[model samples]
Target: MTTGMEELAARMRDFAQAREWEQFHTPKNLAMALAGEVGELIGEFQWLTPAESSSLDEETFDRVRSELADVTAYLVRLADLLGVDLIEATKAKLEENERRYDANLYRGSARKAPH
Candidate 1:
């Protein structure tokens, strides 16, 4: 069963292949692109207060959405290229986090777990 993210990764693979862009899609390049996209996303919220960030106006929200898509595309493509299953990795990370940051111990706190 192909997950939606898997399908999207396939589509991205095809997109790059069709454009002969794979040569430019090295892991380092993709990671940098993903970081740039995240920076763009952050820019959309840079001047907004927490409340304003949460309640973005339509135009700002759309820009944020587009940046998020860019970030996700690079992430998915990078993971696919490296043979990493994003879904499984995310699940495993979530399980690890559940152990590391027990809700009973960390609820409503912003502090990092003790190392």
Candidate 2:
């Protein structure tokens, strides 16, 4: 069956098509731009409280949205390039999480390493 991941990817592709940007989305270029976006995200929180980070002004909001779009675009492109079934991957991760963080140990406990 078709999945949410597939639909989101198709929508992303359609967005690129509408913008005529597919020509510029080479994997290497996208990866480089993705790092830039991540840096921008980190820049927002540098030496700031969670409250301060949450109270971003309009320019910061726009920067965050643009950078988040970059991250999502890069991730979707990578997932597509790798032929990964992301829904399946997500499910697998959840299953692994359940095994690793069993209720007896991690439920309502302090956030510590699994080991």
Which candidate achieves the best lDDT against the true structure? 1
Cα RMSD, model 2: 3.8
Error of 1 at 23 (Å): 0.7
Residue 82, candidate 1: Cα error in Å is: 0.5
State each model's C-alpha RMSD to the native: 1.7, 3.8
The alpha-carbon lDDT assigned to residue 68 of candidate 1 equals 94
Candidate 2 residue 3 Cα shift, in angstroms, is 5.4
lDDT of 2: 0.78
lDDT of 2 by residue, 39-90 (tens): 8788867877889788988988898888787787677776775677767899
- Candidate 1: clashing pairs of residues: none
Candidate 1 residue lDDT tens string, 13-33: 999999999999999999999
Alpha carbon lDDT at 16, candidate 1: 99
Clashing pairs in 2: none
